[model samples]
Target: MRRAPRRRGPLSTVVGIVLLALMLFPVYWMVNASLQPTGNTLRGGWFPLRPDLGGYATALRDQGRNLVTSLVVALGSVLLSLALAAPAAYALARFRLRGTDLVLLGILITQTVPGIVVANALYGAYADLGLLNSCLGLILADSTAGVPFAIVLLHTSMRSIPGEIVEAAQLDGAGRLRVLRSVVLPLSRNALITAAVFTFLFTWGDLLFALTLTTTGTVRPVTLGVYQYIGAHTNQWNAVMATTVLAAVPAAVLLVVAQRFVTTAATDGALR
Candidate 1:
C-alpha cells in the first residue's frame, strides 16, 4: 500500500518554500517578540541582536506551576486516550460486528461539534458532581476529544493488519487481548505513536474546557494561566510571548521527533 512520491518542479518547490515562510513568519515573530525587552506592544526588531531572558524568567516564576499542570493534564489525557482507544479500536477493526460504521459515524459527528458546545454541556454535570477545578476533571474534559481521535487513527492502522495473522495467533492459543497486544498493536505502532503525539498536542493546547470546567486558580493549566496573565499584565507582551513560546515547546519537540512515524501512519492509512 505504498504511495508514490510526487515529483515537484523547482518552481513549485520555490513556491512551497515561500508559502511555508509566510506561514511560519508569525512563529518567528513570536520568538522574536519573546526575546525583545518588555514593552506595551509588539515592537521587536527583525532579529534579536540583544536577546533578553527577563521575559522567560517572569513566565517561569509566575506560570511554572500552570505549565506543570498543563503537562500533567496532557500526559493524563494521552494515557487515558491510549488505554481506552486501543481496545476500542481493536474491537472496531477486528470484529465484523453490525453497526460498527454507525459507531464510527457517531464519533466523526462528535469531532464536528464545537468545543464550546461540549464545554458548556459538561459544565452543569461537572458542577453537580463537584469535579470543578480538579485535574481529573480537566483530564476527562480533554479526553472527550482525544479518545475518539485516537480510536479513529488506531482503528485505521489496526484494520490494515492481516486478518490471517490475527487468526493464526488465536489458533495458537492467544486470546483476543493477547492477539491485540502481540500482533495488532505491534503492527500498528506508527499509528499509535501518531495518535499519542496528537492527543498530547490537543490536550496541551486546550483552553475552552480549561476555562469552562475550572473556577479557581487551584488547578489552572498553562493556557488558562497565559490567558489570565495577559489580562493582568497587558504591558508585559514579552512575558506573554515567552510563556506561549514555552508552552509550544513540548508540542514542537514531539512533532519533530515523531514526524517520521506520523508520516508512515498517514501513508498506511491512506494507501492500505
Candidate 2:
C-alpha cells in the first residue's frame, strides 16, 4: 500500500519562506551593491541593471593591506586559542578535578563582560609593554576573547568520548600524553575544527579591539580597514559594500569546508 503524503500548513510554509528570504535578501543585496556602479549606490535605484566589477577592483586595491593583516590576525588567533584551550578542555573532559564545574562556569562568565571594558585595560597594558600597533598584540588580544568559548565547546566534545576507550589505552601501558594523542585527539577533531572556525570568525570580524589596539594600517584588520572609506567629509558606499562582501568570503569558505564537522561538534557538545 502507498503511504499518504505529509502536508505542511499554509502558515508554516509562509513563515519558512519569509525566514529564508529574510536571510538571503541581505546577502543578495550585498552582492548586488558590490557589482553596482560607484555613483548609483546612493541613488536608491533598483538592483543594478548593468553590473560591473569596478567596485570590487577598487576595494581590492584600496584594502588589500588591511585584508592581509586581518587574515594574519585571524589565523594567528585561531591557532593560539585552540592550542591553549585544547589541553584545558581535555583535562576537564577526562579528569575528575575538584571544582572543575566552577572553573568552567568562571570561564563562561567572562563572556558576559563587554569587550570595551576589557579593551580599556588591555590598551593601557599593551602600551606599557610596547606592544601597541603590533600584529602579535592583536593576535593575543583576540585569542583571549575566543579561548574561553573554545575551551567550553571542546570540553563538551571530549566528554562525549567513552570512558572505556581511555581505560583500554591505559591497560596497554600508554602514558597520559600518548592516550590523549591516540584516543582523545582523534575523537575530538570535529570539535577542534568547529572551535577553530568560530575563533577565526570572531577575530576576523572584531573591530573595537582592532581599532583600539592597532594604530597603523599595516596592523589593522579588514574590519577596521573598511572604516577608512568613511571619512569626516565623505563616505564611499560602493567601496564599503565591496569590502564587506570580501570580508565575509573567508568565513563563508571556512563554514563550507567545516560544515560536516560543525554539526557533529554541536550535537556532541550539546548532548554531553
Candidate 3:
C-alpha cells in the first residue's frame, strides 16, 4: 500500500513560502535592476515601470564572445572529466583491489584542497607546456574540479549495481571494457548526468583559473568577462546586471532540465 504524502500546516506553509521568497528576492531584484535605465541603478524604482532593453543590448554586444568561450570550455571540461573519471570509477567500484579505502580517502581529500592551490601549481606547468590562455588549458584546469568528484560519485553509484548482474555479463563472455560500456554505463545513467551537470556548472562559472592562467585578451571565460565588465562599466549598473543575468541563464536552464535526473541519482544509490 502507498503512503499518502505528508501535509504541511498553515504555519509550515507560510514559513516555507517566506523562506523561498527570501532566497528569490535577489534574483527578482536583479531582473528589476536590469530593466532600469542605463544610469545609476541605485536611483531605480523597486519595480521597473519603464523597462529598458538597452542594458541587454549593450551586454550582448560586449560579452557575447566571452559567453561562447565559457560554453566551449564548460563542454570540453565535461567531456574530458567524464572520459577520465568513468573508467577509473568503474575499476575502483567493481574490482576489490588492495588499499582501496586509502585511495578513496585520498580522492576525498582533493575536494578539501583550495582551488587556488591547484591553479598556482598548474601555472608553471601550463606555461612550460604552452597551454596557458588556451581553451585546452582552461578545459584541463577545470577538469581538475570535475574528475575527482565524478569518480567518487560514480564509484558509489556503480557499487550499487548487483554483483550477480556483473558476473552474469562476464559469464556471457563479455570483457571488462564491454561490460562497462554495455551494462554499467547504461545502469548508471542518472549518476552520469548528475556528474556532467555539476562539472558543467563548475567550469561555466570558473573565475580563478581564467584570471590566473590567462594574461592576454585572446581568450576569456564569461566569469572573467563579467569581472572585467564590472571594472569597466561601474557607472552602467543595468548593463552589468544584464550581463550577470545572461551569465546565469545557462546554469538555470540546465538545472531545470536536469532536476529529475539529479533527484533520481541521489535516491537511486540509497535505495539500491
Error of 3 at 96 (Å): 2.3
Q: Which stretches of candidate 1 lie over 4 Å from their true place?
A: 1-10
Question: lDDT score of model 1?
Answer: 0.93
What shift in Å separates residue 173 of candidate 3 from its native position after superposition?
2.8
Model 2 residue runs over 4 Å out of place are 1-6, 232-235
Candidate 2: 10-residue stretch with minimal lDDT: 228-237
| Candidate 3 pairs with clashing backbones | none
Instruction: Judging by lDDT, tell me the better candidate of 2 and 3.
Output: 3
- Which candidate has the top score in lDDT? 3
lDDT of 1 by residue, 216-261 (tens): 9999999999999999999999999999999999899999999999
**Full ranking by lDDT:** 3, 1, 2
Worst window of 10 by summed lDDT in candidate 1 = 36-45
lDDT per residue, candidate 2, 113-173, as tens digits?
A: 8999988889999999998999999999998888998999889888888999999999999
Count of backbone collisions in candidate 2 = 0
> Which pairs clash in model 1?
none
Local distance difference test, candidate 3: 0.95
User: Could you estimate the TM-score for every candidate?
Assistant: 0.93, 0.91, 0.96
